[model samples]
Target: MLASPGAEGRADLKLIEEHVQRMRWHVTRSSFADVGQAPAIEQRTGFTEAFLYAAQGFAHGIVAIGRAAITTDNKAYADVLERLHQRGVFLSYLPGTGGPEPT
Candidate 1:
């Protein structure tokens, strides 16, 4: 038996929502930068602005990835998606990727 198109679409949407929720949880659980993990500028008084900038870039990357995921043969967006994904992978290996929120 074959699933209806509507049912398949709903399943896809549900999966996407689950992925979004997981990403949100990870973002919320992470600190902007853990103590001694940030550069001098960020450590002293630059955290808010720095985090805002990083968040902006991350949001843009998400949009790029979503676009690429739905587009066919879109090289530019696909490259952006890979770069953003690679950055996240690299960060996962960093020493302070997760910890209590910075003070």
Candidate 2:
């Protein structure tokens, strides 16, 4: 995820939405690329980059949730953390995995 401005500021949901949209487009387009087309190179690279960005975002989000958990007693944050945990993002980076790993 991009470094947010200020420690305690509102999140830009629009930015997050755009990121999701971009990633979706990259994957969709890349999946349709043929073996040896000029556009295939671009599409494949975009897909790889988008996936890497998403993985990074998940890792950063987990860290933020932990910090929020200790610094405050917000039930909303707890709920969010639970949802994230349920999605298996917490353990998404175990042993061997395909594609780019989270940093």
Candidate 3:
């Protein structure tokens, strides 16, 4: 399914909430740079932002645990997605790629 605004960042989370299932994988609509390039906002000590990337996929769902925060720590979003994907939990998009491989 396609991702909505602020939906991509927490796509898996939202899907879990609605469907009570797990998101096996999804190709990222936007790259890590893309998400980082999204407008940054002020945090208590830093700046950050959150955006969602889209991907084509089969059956899945999500559940957001918290809010999206803008941050200068560009690696945070990518890191979370990467760790999850590497562990065979979630997947992110890549340019000109079909999608991420299941871990």
Candidate 4:
């Protein structure tokens, strides 16, 4: 995750999308939005670096969450997802509580 301010930020979404696409993981806005936006608080005091830092930190968390998902079972998935979202690491798709049925 590359964090850019102003002009730099303009390319962030596209760059992220391109990276995922190149890996053959199509990026949907839903997924990206789920990633959330870097907070604008940095702009308040010419401290834009804060936003980038937050973004980078969140990116690391997202990576860790993905790793957990790949290594754990379904029961653990919801736990990780919840933790990530609470920590502001990643976004989630919310629906009714019931999940997929056995195929």
Which candidate number maximizes lDDT? 4
* Per-residue accuracy of model 2 over 1-103 as CA lDDT, tens digit each: 2212343212422333344455442212111111222233224443234334434552322211113211233574355345545544431111132312222
Clashes of each: 0, 0, 21, 1
Of candidate 3, the 10-residue stretch with the lowest lDDT total is: 43-52
lDDT of 3 by residue, 4-77 (tens): 34556466435423332333344223322223344533322111112222222222211223224222355765
Model 1, CA-based lDDT: 0.31
Q: Where does candidate 3 stray beyond 4 Å?
A: 1-16, 19-62, 65-73, 91-103
Candidate 1 on 2-94: residue-level lDDT in tens? 001255534644454454455553332122222332333323222333234444554222211122122234474355336545544211111
What TM-score does candidate 4 reach?
0.28
TM-score of 2: 0.26
Off by over 4 Å in 1: 1-5, 25-69, 75-103
Q: All candidates' TM-scores?
A: 0.27, 0.26, 0.26, 0.28
Measured by TM-score, how close is model 1 to the native structure?
0.27
lDDT of 4 by residue, 16-89 (tens): 45545554543433222112342333222222222233345634222111222122346555554555456565
Off by over 4 Å in 4: 1-5, 30-82, 85-103
Error of 4 at 26 (Å): 2.2
Q: What is the C-alpha RMSD of each candidate to the true structure, in Å?
A: 16.6, 17.3, 11.5, 13.2
TM accuracy, model 3:
0.26
* Alpha-carbon shift of residue 43 in model 1 (angstroms): 47
